[model samples]
Target: DKYTGQPLHNAVVWLDLRTTELAKELAKEGGQDRFRHVTGLPISTYFSAVKLLWLMRNDPAVAGAIREGRAMFGTIDTWLLWKMSGGHSAGGVHATDVTNASRTMLMDLKSCEWHEQTCKELGIPPEILPEIRSCSEVFG
Candidate 1:
């Protein structure tokens, strides 16, 4: 979705280390221990939240879009699903399976849902988050 009315052609891949500093900041602010306990993952640049934080901090357009409540985020699978179902213009479903959700570092390991507290702490808009779904169910 081009929330900024400007096409965002780039993607911050999982292997991208550009979020390394942001990851460290997150670990310090929220503590690595708590993160592991809730998400069963360490605070690292490998996760989506950290990369998102980096973008929000560095990209003016992205930050503006998010602030305007027009941004959307998802992992590759979620993006693919949205495209397959229908593009944003078609009201595509933004959804993801539990296993894929677990890897995002934004979903609760137990509830398999996006934790509002964590999202607030990270300055991530909950509206941009994808809906959590069962792995076996058809999503959109």
Candidate 2:
């Protein structure tokens, strides 16, 4: 579940090589597909934000966590970085990589940041959103 009270289960974190190959296949099958160009990866519901929403709606603990700000919402990369950085609550480096952010449908494709409108549309709070960053940048 995400810190935003989003429920998540069976979340799949696609490995870099696997994601790349999937994107290539998708591009080959559907020539000039914008998904591959924009995201640099194949689109998959498994790696995205829908599950997070589900968790938020169903899990009471998750809902409380989000409200407290003690929980953080992030993709796999962001979670990893937070854990690696000592998980400090004050400035714990909560963030998400561009590619992972793109899959969420919550991030603006162009700005690479959480979209307020999207959050509202999805019944999510902008407050719990993760900071967006480039895939290569270090979070620590």
Candidate 3:
């Protein structure tokens, strides 16, 4: 099952390209030169992070999958990369772009990495998480 449920109805899925543009504009407007390296997209509620959380709370299967690490969670691009790279489970590339990671409300924006504190605050386990990566990269 693809897990297409009604809760997903009318939900907005933000794309990385669009998010990157918005981040660029926001940085420019704020006159923050450091924003140059703030590549990728800006965080938004439409991303999978929020949805994933919702699912974990309301859907038992998703929660169980997460706990068991049987399911791989990530944005569209990450899913694509995983599939394209031979889907190797052992040492498989489980990762997310910074933009997508930002949307999860789980990563520390400054560090571009998963925030253990944030995970604890959100009641999510940090152990089964994927690594956050730069937006521009050549996937294996």
Please report the candidate that would top lDDT against the real structure.
1
lDDT string, candidate 1, 35-116, tens digits: 7877888888888888888888899878877887777788888878877787666777788899988987888888889988
Could you give candidate 2's per-residue lDDT for residues 31-81 as a string of tens digits?
533344444433443435445555566677667776776556777677677
lDDT of 3 by residue, 1-140 (tens): 11321122223365423344433443454443322233232334344544555556766866776666565566666666665664554344667787777766567768887777646644577765667878787556
Which parts of model 3 have CA positions greater than 4 angstroms off?
1-45, 88-91
- Candidate 3 global lDDT: 0.55
Clashes of 2: 6
Please give the range of 10 consecutive residues that has the lowest summed lDDT in model 2: 1-10
Q: Stretches of candidate 1 above 4 Å error? A: 2-9
Ranking by TM-score: 1, 2, 3
When 2 and 3 are scored with lDDT, the better candidate is: 2
Reference-based TM-score of each model:
0.90, 0.64, 0.60
Better of 1 and 2 by lDDT: 1
Error of 2 at 116 (Å): 0.7
Candidate achieving the largest TM-score? 1
